[model samples]
Target chain A: MARQLYELCGTDPARVFSPFCWRSRFALAHKGLDFESIPWRFTETERLAFAKHDKVPVLVDGARVVPDSFAIARYLDEAYPERPSLMHGRAHAYRFIQSWTGTVFHAALIRLIVSDVPPLLDEKARSYFIESRQQRFGMKLAEVTRDREARLPEFRAMLSPLRDAVLAQPFLGGDAPDYADHVVMGAFMWARGTSPLRLLAEDDPVWSWRERLLDAYGGIARATPRAEA
Target chain B: MARQLYELCGTDPARVFSPFCWRSRFALAHKGLDFESIPWRFTETERLAFAKHDKVPVLVDGARVVPDSFAIARYLDEAYPERPSLMHGRAHAYRFIQSWTGTVFHAALIRLIVSDVPPLLDEKARSYFIESRQQRFGMKLAEVTRDREARLPEFRAMLSPLRDAVLAQPFLGGDAPDYADHVVMGAFMWARGTSPLRLLAEDDPVWSWRERLLDAYGGIARATPRAEA
Candidate 1:
C-alpha cells in the first residue's frame, strides 16, 4: 500500500489542526517523504481501531504502523537513515522540550484558544470536544478564556525559554529546524488553524521564527488552511 | 600551566556554589578531565581581567582561555572529541534546555533561596549580593523569600517539564547524563551549597533524579562540601 498518515482535521478536511498531527506532518516534510493524508476527526475512535490507537497522526508506511507523532519521527529516522535526522539518534534529549510543550505550552494555549475551537467542528465532535474539555477545566470554554487578552502577558512570559532559544539560533535544533522546532511549531499551527487570536506580537522574535517555518519546505505549513487570513 | 577552572565560592573557598560554575565542573567530570579549582568570589571581577570576561567558571585549558559554562562544554567536546560527546554534535539542540534552566528554573529557584545565600558569603560579597539582588528584585533579599514556605507548591509545579522528562528516562540524555543534565543539576547544586531549604520533597520523582546526579560521576557532586548536612 502507498504510505499513509491519518491526520486530525475539522469539518473541512483541509483544515488539519491537531498539534500532534502537525508534528508528524512537519516531520514528513522535513524528511522529503510523501504520504497520503487521511483526514481523521474527533469522536472517531472506531475509525482508528485498525491501528489500535484512538488518536490521529498514525503512520502506515508499507508494513509498518506507527501511532504517535514521536514514534513516527523515530520510525522515519530509523527506516530512512539517509533522510535528514529528526532526533539525531538522541531521541531522549528532545523529551524535555516535548514535556514543556505538552504540559506548559499546551496548557496555557488551550485557555486562550479553547473557546475558538468548537465552531470549527461538526455537531457530534463539537459536543464531544466541549464536554471533555469542560470537564477537564471544570468550567465553560468561554469562562476559561474570559480574560485571555489580559492573560496574554502571562502566556507570553511563559514562553521565555522558547523565545530565548530561538533568539540564540535560527531553530530549536540549531542552525536548521529539527524535531524540537516541529514540536513547538505544532502548537502554533493549532492556534492558527482554529483561532484567529493574535497570540504573538509582530515584533517578537518568535513571530519571525514562525514566519520562517511557515515558508519552509516549499511552504507546506503556509499552504495549510487556517482560521485567519 | 596546569588546567584550571575559576569557580564562584563564598567565604570558604571549598564552598563552590555558582550554578554556571557547577555546569563546567560537571562537564569536566563527565569528560574525565582533571583541573585545579581556583576559587572566585562575587566581588572578584578584577581578578578575571586576564579572560577579558567578568564571570566565574572561566576555564583555562592550556593556551585556550574559555569563559562561560556553555562555551566550556563546547570547547571540551571539540578539543577532546575522542573522550566523549557532550552535545553529540548537536550543540544547538541543547539550547532549549539551557534556556529553560537559565530563564525558568533559575528564576524560580532564586526567589526561594535568595535569603539563604547571604550568610554563605564573606562580608564584602554579602554586601554586594544583598544590594545587587535587592535592586534587581526591588525588595530586600529576606523580603523576597519571606513567604517562600507558602510558595513551595508553586515552585515545585514549575518543575513539571524536568520531572516529567526524568520520570520517562533515567537521565535528561536518556540512559546517561549529558550536558543537559549538567545544566539543570547545576542549579540544584547551587541550592545544596547555599540553602537549608527543602527544595525537593523526599518522595518526589525530581528528588530521586537529583539523588542520582548527586551520586553520578564517582560521587563528585555528593562529595562536594554543601551547606546542608
Candidate 2:
C-alpha cells in the first residue's frame, strides 16, 4: 500500500487547518518523506475506525499505522533514522512543548479564531464544529471571539515565552527546525488557514521565526492555502 | 581555587532562594561537582563584578567564571562532557522551557510569594527587595500580593503546562531529571524557601513531581531549610 496521511480540512481539500495535522505534515516534510494527503473532515470518526482513533493526521505507512501527531513524529524518526531527526531520540523532552501548545497556545488561539472557522467548513462539519465548540466555551462561537481585536494585546502578551525563545534562536529547536518548531508552527498554520486576522506584528521575533519556517522545507508551509490573500 | 557558586540568600546563609541560583545549584549537583555556596545578599552587586554580571548564580571554577544560570548549565555540560548530559548537547532545545520558566512560571509565582520574602531578608536586602519589587509592581509589596490566598486557583491554573508535562512523565526531560527539570524545580525551591503557603495540593501531579525532585539527589533540595514548617 502507498504511504498516506489523513489530514483535517474543510470545504477545500487543499486547506488543511488542524494544528495536530499540521505537526504531522511538517514532521513528514522534515523527514523528507512523500505521502498522499487524504483530506478528512470534522465529523469523520467512523472513517478512522481502521486506526481505532477518531483523529486526523493518522499515518498509514505501509502496514504500520500511527494515530497521534507525536506518535507519528516518533514513528518517522524510528523508521527513517538516516533522515533528519525530529526529537533527537528525546521524545519525552518534547512533551512540555506539546503540553504548552495544547493547553495554552491552542486555548488562547481558539478564542481568537473560532468564529472564523465555520464559514470554511461544509454544512455537516460546520454544524458539528459550532455545536461542539460552543458547548466547550459555554457560549456561542461569536460570543467566544467577541472583542478579539481588543484582546489581541493580551493574547500577544501571553506569547512572551515563544517570543523570547525565537529572539534567542531562529527556531524553538535552536538554529534549525525540529519537532518543537513543528508543534508551535502548527498553531500558526491553523490561524493562517482559518482566520484572516493578523495574529502577529511584522516586527515580532515570532513573526520572523514563522517566516523562516515558512521558507524552510522549500516553502511548503508558505505555499499552503491560507484564508488570507 | 576551589569551585564556588555565589547564590542569593537573606538573613541566613543557608537560605539560598533565588530561582536562577537553584538552577545552577541543581546543575552542579547533577554534574556531581562540589562547590562552596557563598550566600550573597540582594544589595551585594559589587561581589559579582568579577563575573561582569549582577546575577546571584555565578560559578567560579578554578580558572573560569560563568555568569547566568543557563550559561552556567551550558558551561557545566561543556566543562564536563563525560558527566550526565543536561541538555544532551542540544542546549538550544532547552530554551523554550527556560523562557517559560522565566516569564510565565516566575512571573506568576512572584505575585503569589513576593510578600512572604521580605521577612526572611536582612535589613538592607529587605529594603532593596521591597523598593525594587514595589517599583516593579507599581504598588507596595503587600498590595502586590493582596488576596493571594483567593488567587491560588488562578495561579495554579497558569501552571497547566508544567502540570500536564509532569503528569505524562517522571520529569520534564523524560525518565531522568535534566536541565529542564532543574529550571522549573528552581522556581519551586524559591517558593519553598520563602513561603509557608501551600502552593500545590498534595494530590496534584506537580506536587508528586516536586517530591521526586526534592528526594532525587541525596535529598539535597529537601534538606534545604524552608520557610514552611
Candidate 3:
C-alpha cells in the first residue's frame, strides 16, 4: 500500500488550506518523506470511512492508518526514526504548544479570515461550510468576520509570545523547524491559502519566519495557490 | 564564597515572593543544589550592585553572579551538567513558553494580586512599591485590583492553554517537571507568596499541577509564607 495523505482543499485541488492538514504536510516534509496528496473536500465523511475518522489529515502509511495531525506527526517521527526528527523525542512538551496554537492562535485567526474561505470551495462544500460555520458561531457567515480590519491589532497582540520568540530565535524550535514550527506555520498556511488580510506586518519577525518556512523543503508551501484579498 | 540567592522578601524574611526569583529558586531546587537565601527588600538596589542588576534573583554561586531568572536557569544547567537536566539541552525551545508565561500569564496575574502585596512589606519598601507600581499602572494600587473577584473568570479563561496541557500530561515537561514548569509555577508562587485570592479553583488541573510542584523538591515552594486574602 502506497503512502497517501488526505488534505482539505477547495474547488481547485491544488489549493490545500486546512490548518490541521498543513501540520501533517509539514511534518511529512520535515521528515523528508514523500507522499501523494489526496485532495479531500468538506462534507466528504463517506470518503474517509476506511480510516474510521472524518478528518482531512488522515494518513495511510502502508498497512497502518493514522488520523489527526498531532497523531500523524508522532507516527512519522516514530516510523521514520532515521529521518530528521520532528519531535526529537520530546513530543509531550509540544502538547501545550499544540493546544495554544489550536485554542488561542487559530481561534483568533478564524475570526479575521473565515468569511474569505467560502468562495474558494465548490458549490456543495461552500453551502456546507457556510451553514456549519454559521451554526458553530451562531451568526451569519459575514457577521463572524465583520470589522476584521479593526480587530487585527488585538489578534496580533494575542501573538505576543510567538512574536517575541521569533524575534529572539530563527524558529520556535530554534536553529531549525520542528513540530512546534509546523504547528504554528500551519495556521499561517491557512491564512496564506485563504485570506489576504496581511496578518503579519512586513517588519514582524513572524513574517520573516513564515518566508523562511515557505522556502523550506524546495518551497513546497510557497508554491501553493494563494487567494488575494 | 558560599552559594547565596538574593530573594525578594517583605516584612517577614520568609515571605519571598518575586516571580522571577521563584524561577531561579525552583531551578536551583530542581538541580538539587543547596544555597542560602538572602532576603532582599525593595529599594535595595545597593545590595544588588555587585551583580550589576536591580533584581532580587541574584545568584552568587561561589565567584560567579547570575542575575536574570532565565540566565540563572541556563547557568545552573551548564554549571551542573551531571545533575538531572532542567532544559534537557534544548533551552532555546523554552523561549516561547517563557515569553508566554512572562507576558501573557504574569501580566494577567499582577492585575488581580498587586493590591494584595503592599501589606506584606515594611514601611519604606511599602512606600517605594506604591510609588513605583502606581507610576507603572497610572492608578492607585487598590484601583488596579478593584473588583478582582469579578475578573477571576477572565483570568482562569486566560489559563486555557496551561489547563489543557496539564490535563494531558502531568507537567509541561511530561512525567517530571523542568524549566518550563518552573517558569509557569513561578507565577503561581508569586500569587501564593503574596496573595490568597484563590487564583485557581480547587478542581482545576492547574491547581493539581501546582500542588505537585509545591510537594516537589522536598516541599521548598510549599514552605514559603503566604498572605491570606
For every prediction, compared with the true complex, DockQ reads: 0.95, 0.92, 0.87
Ten residues in sequence with the least summed lDDT for candidate 3 chain B: B220-229
Candidate 2: clashing residue pairs, number: 0
Best by DockQ: 1
Tell me the TM-score of each prediction against the true structure.
0.99, 0.98, 0.97
Candidate 1 CA-lDDT value: 0.93
Candidate 1 chain B: worst-modelled 10 consecutive residues by lDDT: B220-229
Tens-digit lDDT string for candidate 1 (B1-229)? 7999999998899898899999999999999999999989888999999999998889998999999999999999999999878999888988999999999999999999999888889999999999999999999888999999999999999999999999999999999899999999999999999988888899899999999999999999988888763
| Winner on lDDT (1 vs 3) | 1
- What lDDT tens digits, residue by residue, belong to model 2 across residues B114-204? 9999999999999999999999999998897888889899988999999999999999989899999999999999999999989999999
True contacts kept of each: 0.96, 0.91, 0.84
**Model 1 lDDT at residue A119:** 91
* DockQ of model 1, rounded to 2 decimals: 0.95
* Strongest candidate by TM-score: 1
lDDT sort, best first? 2, 1, 3
Q: Estimate every model's Cα lDDT from 0 to 1.
A: 0.93, 0.94, 0.92
